[model samples]
Target: MATSELIYSVSELNREAKRLLASHFMTVRVEGEVSNFSAPSSGHWYFTLKDAQAQVRCAMFRGQQQRLGFRPGNGDRVIASAQVSLYEPRGDYQLVVEHLEQAGDGALRQAFEKLKTKLLNEGLFDESRKQPIPLIPRKIGVITSPSGAAIHDILTVLKRRFPVVPILIYPVAVQGESAKFEIQAALETANRRKDADVIILARGGGSLEDLWAFNEEIVARAIAGSHIPVISGIGHEVDFTIADFVADLRAPTPSAAAEHAVPNQAEWLGGFRFMENQLIEKLRRQLSQHRQRLNWLEKALQIQHPGERLQRNAQRLDELEQRLNKAMQLTLKQNQHRLTLGSQKLKQFQPIDKIAQHQQQLQYLQQRLQRAMDLKLVTLKRQQAGISQTLQAVSPLSTLERGYAIVQQHDTSKIVKAAADVALDTLIDTRLAKGRIVSQVKEIIRD
Candidate 1:
């Protein structure tokens, strides 16, 4: 045996290394931060687990990834329970991760939290931005995978609870790499079509990676901007996505989404039956009350008799007539007494008796009238004597007897006794008390 010179090819050496590693470390738990974590199209995750000094390659198969609560991302510190193995083709040592947990702050969880905070600050997660789900949506648009169990669950619930509400499905990928874009496009289509009153974004329970499409910023914004109200029914009750925050309503399950969108037929029917019974009872009570009121009114009308009222009025009229006659008799007696008293007073002041008693006064008046006439005759005689005296005092004959004359200017009818009254040789008139003479001025005399 050539114990000193045994040779092996690279493939054989790699195979031998894999077998040795697998036998020594069948299962192990390692804690490190993930670097370059990636899930390719092959449904397998390849990543590097590194510490400060060293690093190791880790592989998670699709079956294990599906069972993980959260997806691993770059810089994620995690405790990975894996089988130590070597890649024959690549000639590298690696860890085949069977289970994993957050070692410290998970990279995926930190990213999720940071994005959530950013969206919240932008008002995308605000209650004011969230719309109200329709109580009775006429048409519901569902954005989900065509083959998912979520659709079937929602349809079954809606059909059983409210069959009248119509549902339209917009099929989209709910998992894997293309899921985010497909979900966003489905939401956009539902909005453009305007065919539905409300929209439902739903999926069955899955790992965080499987549910990542709902957490994408594009999908979250689409849900927030949709004119129709959105109900997020993604994953199980324990799982929450960003779409749940942005949607108008969040339902724990697909069935619960249907229940939230519309009211249950059985419950509605029960309420309607109760209301109907109450209405009927109220009507019966009202009718009975009205019937009682009618009977009372009939009894009251019987007590009001027109003939009796007229008879009572006539009795009152007769009593008033008797009182009026008594008043008239008393008035007549007072008038008679007043008339007798007035007659006695008239007898005391009778005009004929007064005339008879004043006969002497009448005689005195006559004597006074006679005296007045005699005095009038005497006063007339005195007045005639005074008139004679005044006529004697103003007599022109007396002046003529005194030899007085009056002269007048002939043309101007003015007295011409002075020389200035007339020019020389002017015509003049001279008058004695009894006569006048016409003369021409021959000489002037000064007085």
Candidate 2:
């Protein structure tokens, strides 16, 4: 166990071989016949770089393909700048291409130059045909593969800068045999819908053959004919296509296309706030002016109508006079009632009324006194008659009427009750019932 050798698995051995080969041949220029060429949906190109002796598997990633100047055919001879490496998963030796160019006659390059010159002479790439990008687009239309990194980068940038803006995606193949037709059809669809304010034709960086769709005359004409503004963001900054020349605007990358499509939300918000403050200040000034005008109008109306003040004063005087008249009438009625009540009280203290009452009372008292005197006189007469009748019962004059005699001395007027009682007088008078007689005493007789 102390002197045991290090063991290696198949994967470890392949990884070690890849590392060693990559370090030894960082950069190499190889001449080969292009064969078994293919470009997958990932924007990576795979082909065979071959000579008469041997052939090597070659891979050109999307990023490194951007430096390719011309398209390579199956039998074309080319020089490819590449790195030697082992594909660990397959344990296969390969070359990773960074740049590719045609070798001897450069027919493809001459054709590219000829086409560019022809288009330039026809004014297809004139600056006058270019339109300006809108400051803020309502909707941004994108044409690219849905799964491509170009679309992802474009969407991420658009969301970060202005999330409120709407986006419409038109999925299409950005490469291969049908890529040109699909791109042209997408441009036509965008124009028919008229929904997007600006159209962006985008794809990640790639070689000339990988980006051949954008170079097609049909795609270039579609971009030129679009009513909506078109922005081209195809390969990297170092790469350019015919679509880039015909589009209204050209951006170096897909993310840059999105940046050019919309303004930053924060900057727009700041501008709106500033405009709001300015509008508020303008409104305030207008309101102040209106208030000043109103004040001036009110003062002018007051100064123009001096007679209105006199008319109001006259109306007030009339109202006060009516009130005074009503007050006087009410006071007169109250005083009349008081006077009537006082007159009734004064009648009770008047001397004339008191004398009249006293005269009636005195007349009543005199009538009562006269009646009492008459009653007293009649009562006294009745009492005197009764007394006369009682005295006559025993009176001598009454006895004379009854034939009884009363005797009296003539000189002394003495009456005799019996013969004995009357002594022999010198002369004795005797009175019969009707007459008196005088007799002398001749004898004293004893009964």
Candidate 3:
């Protein structure tokens, strides 16, 4: 044993000590006042837990911090569930905090839960009781510390989005014993003034104890009773206070509250421009349709005019006259042929009595032919008159005389039978009872 003596470095000694402490006191629960609490960027909480006679260093890793129901601060008495360990690098004994809660705060948590349950049963958190945020507020009232960063953040956001809206500040203490009373007073004052269209109750991020003022029952009741809509922007996004539930609206931050209270000027202007464009397009379409209708009417008037009717009637009358002349000429030719045949027959007989008898017969036949021609001519004249009358009855011009008009395109001279056949601003002709009119289309109505 004397010959086996071994040398050890400082690191090796510390490692052995850490291994022994970790193995023996694997788990523990300690009670003490938290002090020198510090949280670094690595998300580890470093603190000293001290009693009247003894003190120990503690470290709560990020994983353990997540399990804490309430944040622990300096002077806060807490029960820490931890593991006994040693820092191998420093060779110092410590407790590795796995879970932590405020000393005797279990009762407070129970009370909070009970109150939350009671209020929920009473319907205080109903969505129907929540008020709508004004899209564009005339004035925004803020209830917070005058010197705090919450007020500055809110003002900055409002100025950026909508600078025209005025702001009213209701300064109040955001912490400590009198903080809840001060907050309630500010809320009442804002409502009494009735100047602000919307109100923002705001505070910066803080620990659970620091934000306890917002969890007061009086603050919640005051927010619910406010005539003006209240928006709660207390603490960080992860923190929820009683005031948040009773508020008309909830924002994650003070700056976000300002954003919810008013409309952005740029967005509103863009919307107005959009609506104006739509109205202009509608008017243009209406004008085009009206122009089409006017053209159609003008064409109808020109087509139905008395002048057009007269010209068409005259042309038809010429056709009738030509036909009558041809019919009379044919009849005359047939009678002339019959007379020549009879004369030939009488001449071939070569007898004086036959010639005299034939002459008398020819005279009588001539008289009878004359009578037949007169009767036939009368019949043909009557037929022609009747046909002319029928044509007049059915003529478009006649319809125009009876208070109708015909529509046609001036360019194509095509009849317009339906509204779809016409277009806006087209040159159209209309025939009336007396004259024709050429006009551009102004409007058209359809069913």
Candidate that scores best on TM-score: 3
lDDT (Cα, tens digit) per residue for candidate 3, span 236-278: 8998888888899999988888888888888999999999999
The parts of candidate 2 lying over 4 Å away from their true place are 1-101, 104-108, 307-447
Error of 3 at 151 (Å): 2.3
Q: Tell me the tens digit of each residue's lDDT in model 2 across 93-157.
A: 99998888886545445555666777778898888988888888889999999999999999999
lDDT of 3 at 222: 90
Give stretches of model 1 more than 4 Å off.
1-106, 307-447
Q: Please give the lDDT score at residue 51 for candidate 1.
A: 95
lDDT against true structure, model 1: 0.83
Clashes of 3: 25
- In order, the Cα lDDT scores of the candidates are 0.83, 0.83, 0.85
Candidate 3 segments whose C-alpha is farther than 4 A from its true place: 1-101, 104-114, 303-308, 322-447
CA displacement after TM-score superposition, residue 413 of candidate 2 (Å): 99
Q: Between 1 and 2, whose TM-score is larger?
A: 1
For residue 325, give model 3's deviation from the true position in Å: 5.3
**In model 1, how large is the Cα lDDT of residue 41?**
97
